[model samples]
Target: MSALEAARRRQSWSKVTPEAPTREQLLPLVAAAGRVADHSSLQPWRLIELRGEDRIRLGEAISRVRGDDEPSTKPLRASLLIAVVASYRPSEKVPRWEQEAVASGVAHLLSLLLDEAGWGVIWRTGDYTRSPEVAALHGLGEDEALLGWLYVGGKPDRSPGSRRTVDPEPLLTALPR
Candidate 1:
């Protein structure tokens, strides 16, 4: 499928099979996302792959940070979780916000690539994403912050159903004469 078509059809799948691609298979796709636009070539981002018991550990930390939400059980929902971390770089030309934007762009592009590869994917984030305990578990550096996670697994038999879209007329604006 064409890139635009792939993007248009992209949808988040909440349910997925237990199967997932290996690091060897996924690294190439992840590498492709590196091509995302980055001002000053800062490349202010990194990804941590979580599987096996690591998910359980993350769940526990999330449980602590966000009580009564029952998010701890979420880690096990997907076969794999790719943690998106914004590794800020000191640049006079590029501010911190721009760096974070670069990281976010990478995550979005990566999600698109994962979906193209027939994987079920969803970018999950919450208030607890920046919690101290959760950051510690991911071993985030002083200049780094957790953006969120891409929960990925094999696609299920069912469709994702229709997606919600907004009209472009309300969002577009022209300069006043």
Candidate 2:
């Protein structure tokens, strides 16, 4: 399927197996997202990959913050976990929010690319995303903030169902005369 077609078919898979793409298989997807529009070319984003035992560590950290014990499998739904971080840079022309938007765009592009490649992915975030403990886990800098994570793995055996068609007519508008 074409890239756009694949994008149209993309859906958030809540459950995925332990199989995932290797670094080699994922590099291209990462590179594809790098081409996203950046007003100042600040590239205000970074990715931290979590695999194997690291996923468990993340669950432990979350449990620590919540004051409860979470299952080790909680973070293991997907074979790989990619923590997307928005690292804003000092810029007079570009506002911090815009920089963060650029980062978010990159992440969406990455998820689209993964979906196109027959992988299941989900963009996950919550209150813990901005927590200090979570930030420390990824070694985020002062200017960096955790946006969310991408849980990715091979597509499951069951069908993902048909893509929903969205009409753009109502959402579009031309400049007033």
Candidate 3:
């Protein structure tokens, strides 16, 4: 499919399942995603692939942080998940923000690819993204940021519906000429 077609299809995806992709399939998708534009040769992104019982471990961590004695059905919904982490090791040439942009690009590409391949994905982030205990669990220091968690799975027994459109006005920024 054309890039335009892919982008159009991607805009409508929601309701991801718990059916995670195999490691073999996941590795290539991630590689393709990382090939996006980086200001320099500095590869500043890392994906923590979680599957099976490991996903359960993360859900526990999230629940612990949220102080929810009950584990939410949300975590168990995915057969696997990829924690798209932004490891911004500051360098004189590449600013910290640029490294983060590169990371975001990687995550975006990864999500688009997954959605195009007929998999369901939701990029989710909340207060947990900055939780110190959560950061340490992922081997991330205070300087780094948790971009999001890509919850992935096969499209469930149902077909996904139509796309949701956003108003261009709020999304657009008019620069003063």
Best by lDDT: 1
lDDT of 1 by residue, 13-44 (tens): 88888898899988998889999999989899
Ranking by TM-score: 1, 2, 3
- What 10-residue stretch in candidate 3 is worst by lDDT? 11-20
Candidate 1 runs further than 4 Å off: 67-71
Clash counts for all predictions: 0, 0, 3
Please give the RMSD to the true structure for each candidate, in Å.
1.7, 1.8, 2.3
Error of 2 at 109 (Å): 0.6
Better of 1 and 3 by TM-score: 1
lDDT per residue (tens digit) for residues 1-177 in model 3: 877888777743356564667889888888899899997778888999777777676777777789999754555667777888888776889998899999999988998998877788888777877887567667886667888788888887776776676678877898879
lDDT of each: 0.91, 0.88, 0.78
24, model 3: CA deviation in Å? 0.8
What order do you get sorting by lDDT, best first? 1, 2, 3
TM-score of each: 0.94, 0.91, 0.86
**Residue-level error in angstroms, candidate 1, position 150:** 0.2
